[model samples]
Target: MNGVLKALALPVVLFTGWWVLSADSESFYAPPLSQILTAFGDTWTLEQLKADVLPSLLRLFAGFLLAALIGVAAGVAIGSSRRLRAVTEPVLEFFRAIPPPVLVPVIMLFAGIGDAMKVIVIVFGCVWPILLNTVEGVRAVDSVVLETARSYGVTGTARITRVILPSASPQIATGLRQALSIAIILMVISEMFAASNGLGFTIVQFQRSFAIPEMWSGIILLGLLGFGLSLLFRLAERRALRWYEGLRAAQRSS
Candidate 1:
């Protein structure tokens, strides 16, 4: 109850203040809070929301999941192999520096204006942070732990699955959290570029038609969608990092 109150109080206060002030504002930039809320409510008919939001969410998830799998795998390989790391580190850093939006036209050339291109762009944007973090996590694991596992005839798949990967999971979780944020950003960008049915497309459509309220609604919905996905990722991270929590507890006690 205390924690909940602490969390809710600031937002409640700020929102109420905004709604009250904006209720009387004459500036075109300052739409009434009620008007914004009403726009949000009216535009979000179940059918329309389902038609737009779901496609955007599906693309986000598909690309993010694929990136996580491949990134983690490649990160582990690179982290463990000096030669591979040497070969790929510069390339990874190079691509990571380039903005993902720039890849849209290049990806379009190869994949066209399709789901593949959207997913590809998302993966390109999201994977580097995750892959890099995974490498750091793997490399940072305690050498004693690695040697102890080796003493028990544990190496290869068993080493990774039972020891290295588990030890790296908290960092991986952190990376995934970052990746989720990037994924949402790229998802909207990709939709705006080439999509027919997503929140981004709707926002563009309403903007072009000069439907300001509806455009505001799409923007608000995108924010809510991003917030919801972030909350879910945080919850999953808490669950997945239980062992890491225990380790922290032990360290603090000592």
Candidate 2:
């Protein structure tokens, strides 16, 4: 309870400050927070959420899950083999150096301006962090642990599943956290281009139509969505890493 209050304290304070400061403001571009909140309530109805928000979320999860799967698999393979890592390092670096947004047009040419394109864009942006982190995590696994597992005849899939993946999960989680932010950013960016019905498209539409309050509301919704997803991710991470946390706690006590 205290932790939750502490976590919310800054946001509550900031929002209260905004409400007080913007109460008597006459700025068109920056309307009162009350007006924005009203618009948020009015604009984001169930139907609107179904039409715009749901699709975006579906694409986001799809891309993020695919990226996680591919990243972990490839990372494990590359990390397990020194020669493969050496050969692929330069290629990985080169691709990772290129900004994902720049590849939007190229991806569109191949994938068309559909949900597939948007999903691909998100995957492209998100995959690198997960892959790189997983690789590093795998490489950083204690050699002693590997030797012990080997001595126990934990070879092949058993070695990877029982020894490697668990050892590397912390770093993989770090990568996933990073990728999630990227996924959200890319999701919006992708929707902004050649899209018709999504949060990004609707936000752009509201902006172009001079619906300032509505646009502000959409922005707020996006922020809230990101926050909610992040909170959920942290919860899942804590659950997934309970064993790791316990180990660390034991070490500290010892």
Candidate 3:
């Protein structure tokens, strides 16, 4: 109830304030809250929304999923193998330091400004956070536990499955959370700057059409999309790391 109230309080205040401030603004910069809501009602109608949002979501899922798989694999390999880590660590760091937006030109040139290009960009943009997080999670595993497992009959695949992965699950989850946020932002940005579909594209189209309310609706929908996705991912993270969380709490109490 307290959490519910906290969430509701901000939106109530913000919407009321926006309603007052933008009710009669002549500029597109301040569209009335009522009009914005109306635009949301129209644009977010099931048929209209499905047409616009589905494509973006499909793209987002594809790119994000691809990145997570490849990133986790690469991360595990790098984290586990000293030789691989030694060779690729600098290169990974160098590439990660560079912004994905900067590579749009090259990506568009090579891949063409389509789904393939956008998905690839999203993959490149999102993979680093996940990969780095996986490496950190793996490295942060307790040395004592590792040694004990080795002392036991646990070697090779058994040890990795029984020990390393469980130890690193928490941080990998955290990394996924971060990567998801980045992916959402990149999805909109990629669509906005490049494509002819998605919420970003719809917003651009409406803005050009001088449909202020509709444009604002696109922005609102985008916000809601990101928020909904974040909340869902957070719940998943909590569920996934419940065991680790319990262990931490026990440790604190002890």
Candidate 4:
């Protein structure tokens, strides 16, 4: 309870300040918080959420999951082989240097302006972080641990699953946390181009039609959604890394 209060303290103070300051604002662009809240309630009806928000979330999860799978698998393979890592390093760096948003146009040429294109854009943006982190993690696995596993006759798949992955999980979690934020951002960006219906689409529509309150509401909704997802990710990461956390705690105490 104390932790939660501490977490929300700054936001509550900032929001209160905004409400008080903007109470009598007359600006067309920057409406009062009360008006934005009212618009949020009116604009984001259940039907609107179904039509717009659902599709965006579906695409986001799909792209993020695919990126995770591909990144981890490829990272493991590449990290396991010196020759493969050497051969792919240049290619990986080249692609990673190119911003994912820039490739949206090129990707649309092949993938078309559909969910596939959006997912691909998200995956492209998110995969590099996961892949690089996983590679570094795998490479950084303790040699003593590897030797112990080998002494016990663990090899190949057993070694990877039981040893390498667990040892590398901390770094992998870092990658995942980074990728998730990218996924959300790309989800919005991808929807901005040739999209029929989505949060980003709806927000852009609201802006273009001069519906400032609705636009502000959409922005608020996006921020809330991102916050909720981040909170969930932290919970999941905590659960996933329980052992790692315990180990670190033990080391610190020692």
Point out where model 3 deviates above 4 Å: 1-9
CA lDDT scores, all candidates in order: 0.87, 0.95, 0.84, 0.94
List the lowest-lDDT window of 10 residues for candidate 4: 1-10
How well is each residue in 8-60 modelled by candidate 4, as lDDT tens digits? 68778988999999999999999999999999999999999999999999999
The local lDDT score (0 to 100) that residue 30 gets in candidate 3 is 66
Query: How big is the positional error of residue 176 in model 3, measured in Å on the Cα after superposition?
Result: 0.9
lDDT of 1 by residue, 28-120 (tens): 545787888898888999999889988888899999999999889999999888899999999999999999999899999999998899999
In model 3, what is the error at residue 136, expressed in angstroms? Answer: 0.9
Q: lDDT per residue, candidate 3, 157-219, as tens digits?
A: 888788887888887887788888888888877887668788778888998998888888888
Cα deviation at 51, candidate 3, in Å, is 1.3
What's model 2's lDDT at 176? 99
- Candidates' TM-scores? 0.94, 0.97, 0.91, 0.97
Over the stretch 1-254, how does candidate 2's per-residue lDDT look in tens digits?
A: 56557767877899899999999989999999999999999999999999999999999999999999999999999999999999999999999999999999999999999999999999999999999999999999999999999999999999999999999999999999999999999999999999998899999999999999999999989998998898789889989999999999999999
Residue 154 accuracy (lDDT) in model 4: 100
Off by more than 4 A, model 4 = 1-3
Candidate 2: the clashing residue pairs are: none
How much is 113 displaced in model 2, in angstroms? 0.3
